[model samples]
Target: MFCRDSESFALFLFSTDPRLIQTATQSGVGGVVVDWESIGKAERQVGFDTQINHDTVEDLARVRAATRARVLCRLNAFGPTTQAEIEAAIDNGADELLLPMVRSANEVETVLAWVNGRCDLGILIETEAAVERSGELARLPISRVYVGLHDLAIERKTANPFQAIADGTVERLRAAFEVPFGFAGLTLPDRGFPIPCRLLMAEMARLRCDFTFLRRSFHRDTFNLDLRYAIARIRRAMREAFARSTAELEVEHRRLLEAIATADGYFRARCEMNRTDAVQAASQ
Candidate 1:
């Protein structure tokens, strides 16, 4: 249901707009992530710029009626109100529940108690604690593990979040879990930042990544193009990447690793320079 096979696909839709869900579903994405995690007042107080969507149930039902794409509801952090939220999502027709900022396997156990195998379970490996305890977490009954690059970068204060993929964090998780594992965020085919799009795709294919989300960049860049066409283009590129001989794939992976190191260095230097500039301005 979550595309555990070789082909990976997903699109993130923050709003409950019917037209948007219809477009994403018809565009060939296998599933849609309905983000309800950002709406909580507690999350907002922490300075997260999460859009509030009040019509999660309505939107999920609409998407289910409109297309065959699986609907995943990402709930806010586990807490006193988690059971209510989890029940609501399940009743509203969500095929899966994704928990964010999880730090321990005990958290997963608690959630599974509520879930009881009604729907698949997923967790975002965004914090250092999650990364460190990944081995223990992987032993649980999770449908998949997605590496949250944006949040992880903020948590680790890394210049480049992609550096984790290059530095073996992802590899370690992959080894720890038999279920599908995914890292990296996807934009439009031509809009890769800090790394080239092709290189990123190659690395995902090499890692045997099961899925990724089409986020802000995809929506912005594909404004003029047909959504199906854009999705097809990326799928095609990844197919081509995986089609290469093992030797060729290895050579390309090495090249991409080198590129990652270079990008990390650039980001670190730029961040340091900006800090220096800020200090100078403050003094003057």
Candidate 2:
């Protein structure tokens, strides 16, 4: 699943736990995705500092206890924080661990090794190289692969949202993985801004993508979006986005075809002129 920054997820948990279970229950979010690596720095070399008081771990556990929502952790990829993050996620009973910036089969192996056969794992394919190796990724014990559209688009030089989808990346991913993957089409730099939830749900349905991370920009009355509105907004945005993307793809295809035709015509004219020169030389 697509896990955005962890700080926001932490804030969401802190604000809603304990006395707000009823409110949180009504919010309809799947769960908060935390970056365990970013949650709190360890004061000691071996573990976190006890002197500095922050009930982050306790709070998270309480939130978990209080809400029906899942707690997913996004760990630092192969960084110093990975171990600590994994430990914290396990201790806090996080439902999933989102491994960020995976580059190779080996990286996936490394994460699996660290998990030591515990906890669910998800991955973010955010690089061109990662896309190239997506097949290997899908074969791993990952729960899901989230389409990191912004990074993928940047790497492919397809800045347009419509072009990005039609660039054959997402399609290729679906074809390759053949499993329901998550998508991040609602974030900044992506045209699916504000996450029309209805579109997100629809696109997810169309692509058979398992999940689409909610666009952080979709405002909520409380710390998070109401699940209903979030889902609706995402679904709506995806449908509109798909339509816009289709139109854009058609235009681009037409433009490219025209350019190719013009090039062919130019080449034929040049060849004809050359033939005329040959005829004149033969007459002489």
Candidate 3:
């Protein structure tokens, strides 16, 4: 297994099922995420197509015992339970702690103080404020950074959650950090919605992304198929990205941004139509 900072394309699978974890580890996954970062997410993402996981510290221990692969635990934002959460995650054998929805440099620093080098650390950039202060976060000894596309879209109230990838927000953050960087997820190379996974891989290659979580779409797409073959296709696509020339890279990126913008327009129109319907129903 490569180190977290290695240039290899690390694929993380989010699951608490030991059977799935065993399969994923056997098939060359970088880590299995036991996500516990669900505080206030439901209210914040209301009316949005998002689901929150209520994974517990026990799940961490379960997954830890299930595989020799790395286990990354994503803790909720800073709050009363943060210290206890950090302690529990470490005690349960988390190889790394990913602090999500952070709002300040102090929050990152606080996690660092609490962890005290017990394990590796990472952060999810999910807010505008966090993006502004990310350069500061990167200077610290964090393991990696993954941009939380869904939460960031909700925070900014954008029609398209992928607007950051289209608008260079992710790239700017990537430029600031010397550590490994990634955003979005990968399923099959021939699959993905709104933005095809192939196009997204081109962008990842363009940005030199070091890691990505395998999205839920991947699970559904690969359930009956060979997991190793699916992962190989993804890795092969990432390599093919580098073979494209500068002009080719820009053209592929422009096509991706155009697709996202088109989706954004449709989403806005649908929201507007829904508002009109609501008004008509109220006045009737």
- Model 2: how far is 68 from its true place, Å? 3.2
Query: Model 1, residue 200: displacement in angstroms?
Result: 1.2
**Residues 78-154, candidate 3, lDDT per residue (tens digit)?**
89999999999999999999988888988888889999999999999999999999878878888899899988988
Output the number of the TM-score-best candidate.
3
TM-score of 1: 0.83
Q: How does model 3 score by TM-score?
A: 0.90
Clashing pairs in 1: none
**Which candidate number would show the highest lDDT if scored against the true structure?**
3
Q: Model 1 over residues 1-284: C-alpha lDDT tens digits?
A: 22332355444444455676777667666677777775443432222222344546666677666656688888877888789988988988889999988888899999999999999999989888999998899789898888877567767777676778788888777677777677776766577766777787777777667777776666777889887788778777777876776688778788878888888777777667766765687699
* Residue clash pairs of candidate 3: none
Candidate 3, run of 10 with poorest lDDT: 1-10
Candidate 2, residues 191-244, lDDT tens digits: the string is 332232334334443454555554444333224545455444434444453444
Question: Which ranges of candidate 1 are over 4 A from the true structure?
Answer: 1-15, 39-55, 265-284
Please state every model's RMSD to the true fold in angstroms. Answer: 4.5, 16.6, 3.8
